[model samples]
Target: MNDSLQVIPLRHVDAERMMELISALVSSAGSGQAQGGNNQLKVIADTSSDRLLVKGSPEMIAKVQEMVNQLDTTPTRRLSGLRVFRLKYASAGHIADMLRGLLANQSINSAGATSTLESASLNDASSTGAAINNAASDSLGSSAAAVSTSSTSGTSTGVGGRPFSIIADETQNAVIVNAAPELMFEIEDAVNQLDSRRAQVLIQAAIVEVSGDDATQLGVQWALGNANSGYGVVNFNNVGASATTLAAAALAGTSTAGISAAASSIAGALIGIGDSRKDSQGNTEFYGAILQALDSSTSANLLSMPSILTLDNEKASILVGQNVPFVTGSFTTSGNNSNNPFQTIDRQDIGINLNVIPHIGDNGTVRLEVSQEVSSVVPGSTGNASGLITNKSLINTTILADDQQTIALGGLMRDNTTTRQQKVPGLGNVPIIGRLFRSDNDSTQKSNLIIFLQPTILRDGGAVASVTERKFNQMRVLQLVIDKNGTIKQLPLSGTEGWSGNVSADYELMPLNPLIPKRDQAPKSTSQGFTRVDSPNSGITTYPLNR
Candidate 1:
């Protein structure tokens, strides 16, 4: 590492802010306004006296400076003229890798030698011998079956095995590589590439408890089946399992006519009494398994429970009245809530404190505290509402309250709107130069800003499992760009340089697809269900999902 190699970490907020600045810079640079004209607001030749002065949008620079400032509690002198490397825009693979790693490490101990790092890139990486050896035999066979046993001696390129190499340029601080796998496969392979002997040694060094559905059931299954194929197991297929289903006779409301009529209004009010199974004919079977468990008098009583620190007796009484049983870990023990309303799961596996109030006799009724800084107030026409509204701001306001899946950055013909605020650069805001450069210029759009960052080192302080890099410098603007407005617009970051759509297609990253499926619920039409057809070659039933 070089002595001047400055390191920086960016949070969600910093990324957003940096993006605003980059967009502004790109817009300004593309516009002819950046040229030295009568519009006194021309671009600045320089900002600081540093020989290697770094320049970027104000928000981008500010965010980087802010992190450095906060982390610098040391007696080091004030740092200045530092080049800002802003990682504003990231690919889907990047985002997915980050989220996956964060969610994967949430539960259990992540402090030992076996513990993985919290950061990763989403690009496919080259495969090593150990990685190929770690994959499940099925998945491995699905990819490269020619891979045979790796040798324990020198060179180790035995029969049927592929000799992969990762060349690190110690002089240039870069890596040269041949073809690499996709990001998802890279992550899958990297973990599998570790030496079993080395892994066991590290596991022994760190007495960490690795327990969970993924780490236990899936882990054991994958580990046991393919000792030669080293790999991690991840699955979300728990759709039709018998252990969790209920019986029809156990259903509460499907009984006698006269007695059923009397209980008709509240018949379906019992818990664990829902249709648990769905047949091929589309019929559902609800059982009373959950309801029976709750009706028993000897079962755990809510009255015997003590009130939580954040909840008063009034709130605690509601839990008893509602007869709501605590539900804990579902997807995995790592993301479980232990049925406590006061704790909600975070992507990082940490529990965030929350105050929940349930409605009487309702299992789904829940009202979480919206206010981080809660206060008390009265309610009336001229007075305060029943509850105080005080100063409360929500995080990630970019996402809708009803559904967080949608994005709301801007619309076409975007004018001065409160929602579509563009971040400007500090130097671009100077008196004479400010007017010449608007952060949202849309004339020339061929320029692009590149960003780079140091890779994450694992906690074990050993070699990283995987690596990825993007050619940000190669990013070129296209003549036609779909702006936030959803309309085609042209823009430049510095001046009147416009993109002519002449950019080579080879420079573009892979086209992206919608992360989530277009529709959530099955279509009302029966034809929307799976269609079973006899195999052309074999007489077997096969159901293909509706495309």
Candidate 2:
């Protein structure tokens, strides 16, 4: 075996795949030379630098070097400077369209124009035009030879008296630009700017049922919460209590600024809401903490906590329910042999659906268009026989709020009433006394629906990582029941300490948004709702959420 090593640099061939083939051959060579001695060849590939490191006998090393040269064949290249730009975030089709528009809008210089970075030439366009005309003429003529077409389409005249063509590859999200070298430089720059990652928004939506005194406290503005009204909220943007009620138009979603004038009305009455308002201990707190305190009681019933992540200016939708099938229309087909009834059944989702499109503003605020609908299938109604009877509450509103600030939506009210009667079997036939044998009962119930929305802007990777870690810690605790509630043991996740379920009390409450302000630490709280509870690092238990 040779004591020294040999280096083989490759250009055209891929180092990783070549290494696999070489390794197999080296193993075979070692097996063949087992009786002789340790002639084992070691092949190491450095994919980054496209080089191979090998240590073997002189004869084996020379043979391997020869194989490398033979396989590393130089491929042909295009005479034209054509390039394909792979985009990470932007759509290739959209970018190509934008480039075409830009190039088309470019003004041509009449005074013996020398093609510059931003400018293109009209003279260069004639060449591409001639090519197109030639292809057309060839196809029209009677010839045996095939008339080939160019993939490049002349979007507009480009730099250096040449016409450039842009083609978008949707499957690979890449844009292929064929143009003069000068124009290619400018095109690359534009693509780089557009291909960068856009900002993302994390929307957390909580739907709760408000009742008791809480419902009364939220009056007109509360109802306006679900639907957009002429009036906005009174206590807007989680600020301290103020007198004049702000109109909903104040935060109406628009490209420009919101309405400054608002008619005076008392909107916010409930106290201790918003992140700006501190708790009893004077610690910065999230309004969700106050809601959690109410969640334990019948005052507030948390219907759902649905969250989604979406790109800026992109729409995100969430549907938390089931699809129900109902007959839409039916037709009977008559034939001499047999008759059959055909029914057209359509399925509709009966649950909570919240759609939101968030636009991240430069001023640390987010404009959102929220469309929320909550519906259920009604029972024992006239429409229920043929089609499904549905009770639905839908609201579509556009509003602007501060970053990480909770937007309150309420005002949807529902009333349910029921009457039941119990009667005797046979003895109840005795006229007036029969009434005494039967018992009657009546009941009426009312509930209000309120939605809370909070949007967090993720500007970079750090913010994403922080949120990821926070969510991981907040996962529900798991328990291992070796049997049916017998010999139970707690399960623990690897890499994570025994701590489970006490996700981030402060992290969840504090703003994770980098664009907005946040608290240094979570406010001190006596309520165990936000308080951290020490639990053994038991195994994870996946339990089905109760309906």
Q: What is the TM-score of each predicted model, taking all chains together?
A: 0.13, 0.46
The parts of candidate 1 lying over 4 Å away from their true place are 1-142, 146-154, 158-161, 176-392, 397-547
Model 1, position 479, has a per-residue lDDT of: 27
Over 426-459, each residue of candidate 1 has an lDDT whose tens digit, in order, gives: 7346676543222221111121111111111122
Mark the 10 consecutive residues where model 2 has the least summed lDDT.
288-297
lDDT of 2 by residue, 61-162 (tens): 887888788767543332364888888989776676566444444223433121222222224422221112001111112232222233344334322244
Top candidate by lDDT: 2
Off by over 4 Å in 2: 1-81, 106-162, 170-173, 210-302, 331-337, 379-383, 414-442, 476-547
